[model samples]
Target: MCILFATRSHPNYELILISNRDEFFERDTHNTCWHTNSSILSPYDMARNQKTSPTNSETFGTWIGINKNGRVANILNLRPADTPPNKSSKGKVSRGMIPFTFLNTDSRKDSFSEWDSFEKFEHQYPCLTTSGDFNFFYGDIKSKSYRIIDTFGQTFKVLDQNDNDSFVLSNNTFNIENTKKWNKTEEGMQKLKELISKTKNESNNNIILMECFKLASICSVPEEIRNKPYHVDPAITYDTIFVPPLGSNDGEDIGLTITKGDFYGTRSQIVILVSKNSKHVTYVEKVLHTSDRDCKTHSAINPKDFHQFEFEIE
Candidate 1:
């Protein structure tokens, strides 16, 4: 599970993205790496290659990333009911590949029309028909456009940047007003609104945005509810719990006990800011802890282990 927040209409920035990566701690995962082509910081699953694979594997990490082309993609698993049966199911394609796949290709200016003009998306990407349901938000600076693409290949473009300046995406169903259906949807949006209110015109404020993301990531659920399911609550699902998969048995023990053999909590946090005028991108990654492969004891480390960089889109 993950939570992604983005603001597109700020005075100083074209976009601001805040994300928390939640997953099993026993799996081998790398924090961030600058891709060979450009200054794209892609946090990859160390265990698998970039190809079609089962979603349950360790390679199923990272649902967000930004490229040097000034294109950004954020994906979330759609609720089963929201996704209809695929008419073009070829086979299972890794849902994690969506962001990177978009980044690999340059975006066109016309938005949805150009993409839909193709004879078949399943033909273009054989996995699209068979991949698990996903909600993808993609934007490109060159195209000056942003939109959401669902598993069914439906696209909803953002016509008014000001109206849809800020958006929060969690595991719950997609709703603009953020109704009080799921526990995290209302609480997370409320916290984001409060933070946005505090810094009214302060665009591209990474520090405050990072803090807001941390708040949403760590916010506790109600105590009245017993037997809290992690999927229903972002607090438990995205909690910053890091466990190294090597050396120490502590990580395995914590994973077994805390999540009851399910995936662990938040492993990494990323904050990205893109400037509209200059098209310069600022990316910051906070790796919560070092793996046991590097440190034997699986010791607790500071969240300040940040890897940051800035680059301009050519």
Candidate 2:
């Protein structure tokens, strides 16, 4: 239950990632911070863990994160669309570990341009594949190109200068090359392109982030559908950027054990902008809903309410 829009087409910025993290409000999460014993910047999912050691002092995994080296990784989960799968969390891997592994490790000191760079990295940490399907984009942001692994982890592609001006992903979209994607995904991509074109000659970064937040908050999910039972599938339930709170009834047919009145929706919105020089970065996250504060309806968004950070590349 997530949506991301990214652009490498902008002249002033090397890469821009606009993301929405949608999940159940009941899940406990920590705000973004500099990871312990590492240069990675990411938030922790207190509910999921990898049990790396007996003490498990290692920080829990994450959904989106970046390293001081300018490497970034963001993940979106995929569900069994047509059929219900085993709902047991036993022996299952947490998807947050995928990004946690990537962001914590260092890239090749030589160059990430090497073809074997990602392959060796992926093999170095086998957590690349998780319990369920996922779609992820990761690479050194300075490169202005991202490698994507699709839902089934079968298709792999790189977004470069010659490709589309922007790329968008949701729980939908089997592959980046695939023609079919959620209309909401298409809308985000189009809006990103427009934003890039409009800000081509502009120098202000705030303008860029404002537009990114606006794009992240746009939605295609109808009010009627949102008011209904929530599912992870694009066609079944989640097909929008800003997901409003939807109730879950512990649907057994769908393998969801959520009890009555447990709501699922977008919990946070993130925007990361890496300047063309690649040394400067702007990161912002706006918390919308949580287990304590459940915003059933969308309200006016303000940037001042967001958690903001700026970091220089190491």
Candidate 3:
């Protein structure tokens, strides 16, 4: 998963996300783009080859999706210390699949129903390994809402609607406890807007957004265990920006702008725009120049395998 941009307040703030997954199974594969319908379960199946992992019987490990309902979710591999296995051999279900699956379902109430349901399901079909932790967040676009469910130790918190207008999801380490005080939705949004306006003159709005994500990406972990790969392997090291169309409406540009880089790597920009609202994307524009040396390294996953792809919110 590359980068995710979303907001609960502006339905027009349609999500703009891009992913470049490295797969050892397919050598010549390219980055593939997909459009998920109201239901995310189907897309999750198509995105992952369930047969590859032994835990497929319970859950397929993958960054499932973010829905237009302002619901953004992703599963991350937990650290070993964060999740110690039980001696009982009943097996554990893959917690990473919870966020993707929750957004796929139609449950509307945010009263821990989603988390409870996931827990019940995992009790039946356990996962293969129980070493890592599972982290998930759900946000409602209309209400400026957000909820973080750190299910390893019953850690759950909801962000107040008045404190934030938009929230970014990244593959970084962050302290769940410190974020509890971040329920000031309105203030957070205002600050974000100010930051964006101040940086908009930098020639690229996408770069400005990347800066916000980097700041929000701050994570907390024990210094001794920080070096250890606790969560998802090859954690998302790059950032991408999802720009809503120039105007605020649906069926608009559906164009997505993306930037890939880290604090040290070269950054390259790519723009995917939909010319026609047909079943598939028609126009894809990318910046000719790149600031990075490895900009030409194609992803192992083919971006064309998925079809009827467009980044617009219904």
Pairwise lDDT winner, candidates 2 and 3: 2
- lDDT of predicted model 3: 0.33
Q: Write the per-residue lDDT of candidate 1 for residues 1-314, one digit (tens) a residue.
A: 56677776555666667776655544566667776465466776654345434654323334677776677777776542222333221225556666666666554332433443113334555666565566677777666667776665665665246576676676544543433345555556566667666665666456655664455355353434322223333234433222222222222322111222333445567778777674777777776544323233222244636788788876
Tens digits of per-residue lDDT for model 2, 51-84? 8777766457778989998889887766434334
Give, for candidate 3, the lowest lDDT window spanning 10 residues.
251-260
Q: Which parts of model 2 have CA positions greater than 4 angstroms off?
A: 80-91, 108-121, 143-145, 173-179, 223-238, 251-261, 296-305
Across 272-307, the per-residue lDDT of candidate 3 in tens digits comes to: 211122122221212211222222332112121233
Quality of model 2 by C-alpha lDDT: 0.68
Q: What is the C-alpha RMSD of each candidate to the true structure, in Å?
A: 7.2, 3.6, 12.9
Query: In what order do the candidates fall by lDDT, top score first?
Result: 2, 1, 3
Cα-based lDDT for every prediction: 0.55, 0.68, 0.33
Error of 2 at 110 (Å): 6.8
Top candidate by lDDT: 2
Candidate 3 has what TM-score?
A: 0.42
